[model samples]
Target: EDYRAKGFFKEALVNFVALLGWNAGDDREFYYLNELAEKFELERVNKAGAVFDIEKLNWLNAEHLRAKDPADLIEPLKAELNSAGIDFSGRSDEYLKSVIIAMRERVSFVKEYIEKSPYFFLPVAQYDETSKLKNWKPETGPQMLRLKEEFAKLGENPSKEEYEVALKLVATELNIGAGKLIHPLRLAVSGMPAGPGVYDILVILGKEETINRIEKAVSIL
Candidate 1:
């Protein structure tokens, strides 16, 4: 807003995407400062106020996140997580790699995964207070805890080999339906009632982080 009034649209446009709410990747991201005037298309621009729509921003973020290679996604996520005091280095890159896969559906931006899934880095400080009480039952916590314990024994990091075995065990023990278990588990770990596929979340967060989140949720209950 400051620079835009000064007739610096290019700098302001870049600034618009860099601050509190920024959409970093355009097909034009690769364009140099020298090419700004030629590449800049004013026709496609939307005129709007700064009353942020989370849904629209999140969808934009997901599109950008998906466009990035898994390996490439890690560096920026790592930088953000590090600034937030999360030790992504100690955790497996495989987990980080798969995390991109897990979160792309639910989150709109790189910052969002950190914001929404802070339990992956920090312990969850606040839960969805309304949903917490509305949805969580005493029995549900223990059921999830028991399943998480069993899930941990599968392997260090889940592979196709171990995942199949774990699914078989889940089918045998849980017996009722995977959705029943998955629903509660998703809520426990993410604090959202729904999200990207569960198996992938487990694969990315890894067994330890997944179990840690479950145990923390159970303790809170």
Candidate 2:
């Protein structure tokens, strides 16, 4: 229960502990509880001591997290959010699910969906210092203003593709690579150097919030 509270899935914990001093006489490491029951053999138990590998447990937990349906993660993720004192009252389940889908592969634990990407729930508190040094430049301010205009043209609820096109058009007019706008824009919206695709972040944030974040970044940075 404590492990579950801490975001380690029960199945993953079971799978990891099972491999401590035993193997199924093969390379396969993942198994369902039922499968473990069927495969366990007294003969395969090792005489040698087992080393507790926290890294392996983390890996297995991530694998299990990815294997489950994103919808199935919502309740537990909400629990984690509540425990963390994040108020998600206004956010819908479907919206939460989209966040899960976007961040699932990038995170190893349920809490990380919130930890690594708090911008989804709250406004950008602080820009990543490294990202500011690397992605934000003298020209980035004006470039972001122009990009904000393009995003404003998108109105509310623009698709990810539309956001991409808007960004590309800005890059073309500026006679710079798309990466120039992409990196700084990512910094503006996510306040981080990396995570999910920037366009996806834009769409998820919607038009008003995206523009507001850009405006905020411009003023602050």
Candidate 3:
């Protein structure tokens, strides 16, 4: 015998299980339990075996996760962060929600979302060496130093638009593609070659922290 077990939202589980051997006689694939109870009919159920599909289950889970209210999503996320020893004393509910909003589309499970996003809670301890070598050029140090200066002029917590404008202005003045600076700056802030948008990460990290990370990256180069 083969056995498998996992967790799911009650409503998603009910909705998923109800579909295994039944059809609603329409193309819709999602419904609330109450909606299912309202529409379910014994005559509509297929007599054939229904193989449980984990991929379909995960898709349903992602849909339900996206539909969740941010307030509803926050407490459990906080608990998971706490359990992982991530400090939340300085981070606000709004800040946490911003992270959840940014991440919800990219994750199927709450824990998976939290586990993959340590950069949200911790500073970039070290830059990725490969990215550093690839993106951090001889002239990149001066360009990043210029980025720090431009961002410092924005005071704390510049808007995303403001961050973009600053980086573009610097890139234009330096006569280089915005990507040249963008990739290295991402490595500076998150120590990764890739993740979220650079301006999104910069705005969330705030001006001082972003500038400081860039300075560190410049020193390393």
Candidate 4:
């Protein structure tokens, strides 16, 4: 019951448990309840105790999690956020939907999805120190500052493509790799070294907030 409350999907659980003592005489590992029911046979059921494999369960859960529609996840996602003591107020439906889209492929559980990106809910107070030490350089601050200025010119609500184009243009102007700016910029906006595509995250965060974050990161350096 606690596991269910923690965001394990029912169909995924069913699919995993059914495979415990039964194999449908084939190489396939995934099947719906109806499909398993049609294939179940008393004689074919293994008499030995079946060991539970958590990896298999997680794999099944991942598939089910991805198959779900983002819209259907909103209420439960809000409930999870409330449980975590994160205020869901002021977040719009469109913003929440964008978050779901950003996170869908990144998490197997709803709770994991919400917990993995707290920056989505709150301002990134500080970046990951290791990422900063590894990725930041003398040129990083100035380049990001320039990138921030470029972003400012885009007006509000630029598409993800526009953000990428601006970043690459700045990198080209500077005659350095875009990665020099990108790595630090990611740390700035997300406080983590990796996440969904950088521009995708920027589009979701919007121009003003994104540029402010870049400026903040430049200040940090």
lDDT of 3 by residue, 4-27 (tens): 124366667777888899989998
Q: Per-residue error at 123 for model 1, in Å?
A: 2.6
- Among residues 3 or more apart in sequence or in different chains, the pairs in candidate 4 whose N, CA or C atoms overlap within 3 Å are none
- Say which prediction, candidate 2 or candidate 4, comes out ahead on lDDT: 2
Top model number, TM-score: 2
| lDDT for each residue of candidate 2 in 34-91, tens digit (9 for 90 to 100) | 8999999989988898999889989999999999899999998898889889999999
- Candidate 3 lDDT for residue 73: 81
Worst 10 residues of 4 by lDDT: 1-10
CA lDDT of each candidate?
Answer: 0.62, 0.92, 0.82, 0.85
Clashing pairs in 1: 17-22, 58-108, 61-108, 62-108
lDDT of 1 at 44: 47
Model 3 poorest ten-residue lDDT run: 1-10
For model 4, the local distance difference test gives 0.85
Model 1 poorest ten-residue lDDT run: 3-12
RMSD of 1: 7.3
- TM-scores, one per candidate: 0.60, 0.95, 0.88, 0.93
User: What ranking emerges by TM-score with the best candidate at the front?
Assistant: 2, 4, 3, 1
Candidate 4 at 55: error in angstroms? 1.6
For model 4 the local lDDT of residue 196 reads 90
